[model samples]
Target chain A: AQSVSQHNHHVILSEAASLELGCNYSYGGTVNLFWYVQYPGQHLQLLLKYFSGDPLVKGIKGFEAEFIKSKFSFNLRKPSVQWSDTAEYFCAVNARAGNMLTFGGGTRLMVKP
Target chain B: DVKVTQSSRYLVKRTGEKVFLECVQDMDHENMFWYRQDPGLGLRLIYFSYDVKMKEKGDIPEGYSVSREKKERFSLILESASTNQTSMYLCASRIRDRSYGYTFGSGTRLTVV
Candidate 1:
């Protein structure tokens, strides 16, 4: 079975600090990657996705992810963090023609203002 | 914008009681899914539907069933709600191409007592 791994369980950052969350998946095939964010008491929203072409994908709210096929990684990054960016981030992947996705353990980010 | 709506924000059920978690999507998507989010386990898929009246078991489908009588609605049922089933349930919808990210609902937090 395919699985995703997120290296960080919880991360605390001061405002304006750089942010990066590591994600690795155990799948060896054409894959589609995604990043989702869940704000406090809010629903999960798509941050970004990678289907094909570009390896680096930019998303809303200054978020971005890079799909590195060789390393099986799709790491989420932000140049600077803000309090509003505090949320739980999840990394998900599915086979190119697969119907379901496998999600990582998730990284809980706390941005301190 | 796509919208996936779960029927409840929170629910409390007794053990051994039947529980139903409802979800509806306004985008007329071809795929709908149910997932349970835990602190460390992340989002574990419970079930999924590709079309009306069609359902497939996911990674964790034991003790759970699903219904999809219409294209816009999907329901997750717990035959006998157990304390271990307490978690946040999320509903999501996606197009058939599998190129885009999923649109998720606000989630229903179910607690069995």
Candidate 2:
């Protein structure tokens, strides 16, 4: 069974601070990675996705993720986060044949203004 | 804008009552999924359908059932609601290919008391 693990439960950062949320998945095959963001009182929205292209993928809202195959990690990162970037981020993974996803325990990001 | 609309935003049901949560998509997507979002659990997939009337069980499918009679509509059913089953349920739709991102609904928060 494939499972996703996020090391951080809550992350607090000041405005313009660099951010990195760790995500690791337990799969040894071709994987599709995704980052979903849930703002306050809003539905989950896809920030970015990586299917078969380059390891580094850029997503919406100035966010990006890198798929490290050997390490089984696809961590979300941003150079500078704003107060409006405060939201819960979730990392999901799906294998080539898998239609559903395995999501990591979300990381709640709070950017202080 | 593409939308995946859930039937209810909030629901209260008894322990032995049958609960139904409906979802409709306007994008004419080929795949739809039902997931439960908890505080520390991220989102757990309950069921998904690739085509109409074709359902597949996800990671956690013990106490939940689903119906996909129509292409644009998918329903989640709880035969007997329990306290542990109380959570925010979300519905999402995606295209046939994995490259497309999923569009999620606003979610339905259910409380079994």
Candidate 3:
């Protein structure tokens, strides 16, 4: 079975501060990676996804993640974060042959103004 | 844009009561999933359906059952609601292809007292 782990449980940052949330998955075979964000009182939305191609993928709101196969890591990063970025972020993985997704424990990010 | 709509934003039920949560998708997606979200737990899959009348057990399906008589709608049922079942329920849908990510609903917050 595939499992995802997010080491960070809570993150606090100020406006204009750099942000990075760690995400790692345990799956030997090929897999698809995704990052979803849930804002306060809002629905969960896709931040980005990596199927195949370049290791680095850019997403909305100037967020990006790098897929490092050797480490089985797809860490989400942003150079500067705004107060509006406060929300919970989830990392998910889907085995290449499976249709279901396994999600991480999630990281709650609080961006202060 | 593809949209997944959960029937209720908030629900309150008593313990041992039979509770039903409905989900519908605007897009004709072949796959639909039910998940429960709790603080720090992120999202845990409860059940999923690949096609009409077809259901598969997800990570946590012990206290839950699902019905999918139609392709666009999937229902989650709690045979006997428990206090531990109080959480935010989310519904998501995706096409058969593994490359694409999921479209999520606004979620239903259920409190079992």
Candidate 4:
């Protein structure tokens, strides 16, 4: 079964701290990767996505993700996190095998002021 | 701008009641998906429709059914609500040919007691 795994369940960091949320998927074929974010009371919004081109994709809010085929990982990263970045982050993977996404358990990131 | 909207923001239902969650997208997307988000489960695919009147069961479709009567509308139906089924239900839409990534709704928080 294709599954997405997130290493950190919860992460707390001070403002200006570098942030990295690990995401790994277990699929042998070509896959599409995505990073989504949800604020305290808002909808889940797309942060970044990787389909074919560019292994590294930049997204809104200064977020970026790296898609590594050998590692089977598409990790979300930001040079610095702010208080508004405090939210839940989800990593998802999809393949032509099925259009459904396999999402990780999510990482709760809390950035302190 | 693309917008996905859920009919309800919060809902309370009895354990044996039938529940309907409605989702609509203004983007005229071809693929619409229903997902449930829980604490330990980031997002479990419940059902998806690739086109009007064409539906497919997703990973966790055992307790749910779906409807796609029109191009921009998809509905998730819980045959019989259970306590264990209480979770945040999200609806998403995407254009199949252009991009596989999704634009998600605000989500409906359902509570079954």
User: TM-score, chain B only, every model?
Assistant: 0.98, 0.98, 0.98, 0.96
Per-candidate total of colliding backbone pairs: 0, 0, 0, 0
The lDDT of each candidate is: 0.95, 0.94, 0.96, 0.92
Over all chains combined, what TM-score does candidate 2 have?
A: 0.98
Model 3 misplacement above 4 A? none
* Winner on DockQ (2 vs 4): 2
Candidate 3 chain B: worst 10 consecutive residues by lDDT? B35-44
* Docking quality category of candidate 3 according to DockQ thresholds: high
- Clash pairs for candidate 1: none
In model 4, what is the error at residue B65, expressed in angstroms? 1.0
Give iRMSD, candidate 2. 0.9
- The alpha-carbon lDDT assigned to residue B6 of candidate 2 equals 97
Model 3 Cα lDDT, one tens digit per residue, B4-93: 999999999999999999999989999999999998888999999999999999999999999999999999999999999999999999
Which whole-number lDDT from 0 to 100 does residue A31 have in model 2?
A: 82
Worst 10 residues of 1 chain B by lDDT: B95-104
Comparing 3 and 4 on TM-score, the stronger one: 3
How good is model 4 by TM-score? 0.96
Per-residue alpha-carbon lDDT of model 2 for B1-113, expressed as tens digits?
A: 88999999999999989999999999899999999999999999999999999999998998999999999999999999999999999999999997677899999999999
On DockQ, the candidate that comes out on top is 3
Each candidate structure's TM-score, on Cα atoms with residue i matched to residue i, is: 0.98, 0.98, 0.99, 0.96
**If you score just chain A, what TM-score does every candidate get?**
0.98, 0.98, 0.99, 0.98
